[model samples]
Target: MGALLNQTCYLCSNTKNSIVFVENGIDIVRCSNCGHVFSTYEQEEHYEGYWDDDSSYDLGWWDHAHREIYQDFIKRFLTAPSGKILDVGCGLGFLLSEFKIKNPVGKPRVTKYPKKRFNLPGIKTD
Candidate 1:
């Protein structure tokens, strides 16, 4: 278990909070006032962890695991037939690829690797 964060609740501005659980070395907290679940770890504004690595990173399991979730998300929210989609940190562009397949009229753009954006394995930007 991790220590309680001194910061106030982001939603209701209440200072009272309790630790929900710790996952992957970060403490997940819940606000006592608004019931909002958030992480206690302070993340960098522009944290370039794995996204900055130029080496070939294969996340085949991630694509396979998130396919159904991405499909459901596109069906639920991305209902627009034509629009601009700006995806930041699109690891392997799985979601964008799914979006493109469902809605081919939209201009889907990834912000991670500009030079290699169109070179993702399963993504086809036509």
Candidate 2:
């Protein structure tokens, strides 16, 4: 069997050595070179769980009222008639979906390259 490659520190970008810091069933790797810290190999998958946690207010919490407020904010400063908007840190396309709902005729787009669950109706993953 091939040897398991250890994950390097995301901050320092070092691969020589690492120190593990385990907390709440998660392992964080700290690099000796720059003293940078990051999670282990399954870091991405691990943090994804935090995003969907019940205690956390993520995409599911965005209701019609929140959409109305967001729309109002957009209309107040933005002059364009909602044409081809891109949400940078789009969590689960809820905001994009809300925007589309508010302006049915307007063009709505989203980027979900990292997260597969966020790819849904009215959202573009590119």
- List where candidate 2 sits over 4 angstroms from the true fold: 1-42, 48-61, 82-84, 90-92, 101-120
Instruction: State each model's CA lDDT, in order.
Output: 0.59, 0.47
Per-candidate Cα RMSD to the true structure, in Å, reads: 9.7, 10.7
lDDT of 1 at 20: 84
Candidate 2 lDDT (Cα, 0 to 1): 0.47
Give a tens-digit lDDT track for model 2, residues 1-126: 222245665434567545465656555666778776765544245445444334445444555447777677667756577555545453544455535433222112223322234334443222
Error of 2 at 80 (Å): 2.6
Write down the worst ten-residue block by lDDT for model 1. Answer: 101-110
Candidate 1: C-alpha lDDT = 0.59
Q: lDDT (0-100) at residue 85 of candidate 2?
A: 56
Residues 1-126, model 1: lDDT tens digits? 765444566446677778888887677888888897877775444454545556587667888899999888777776787644646343666676665433222113333443254444433332
CA error at residue 120 for candidate 1, angstroms: 6.9
Q: Which candidate is the best by lDDT?
A: 1
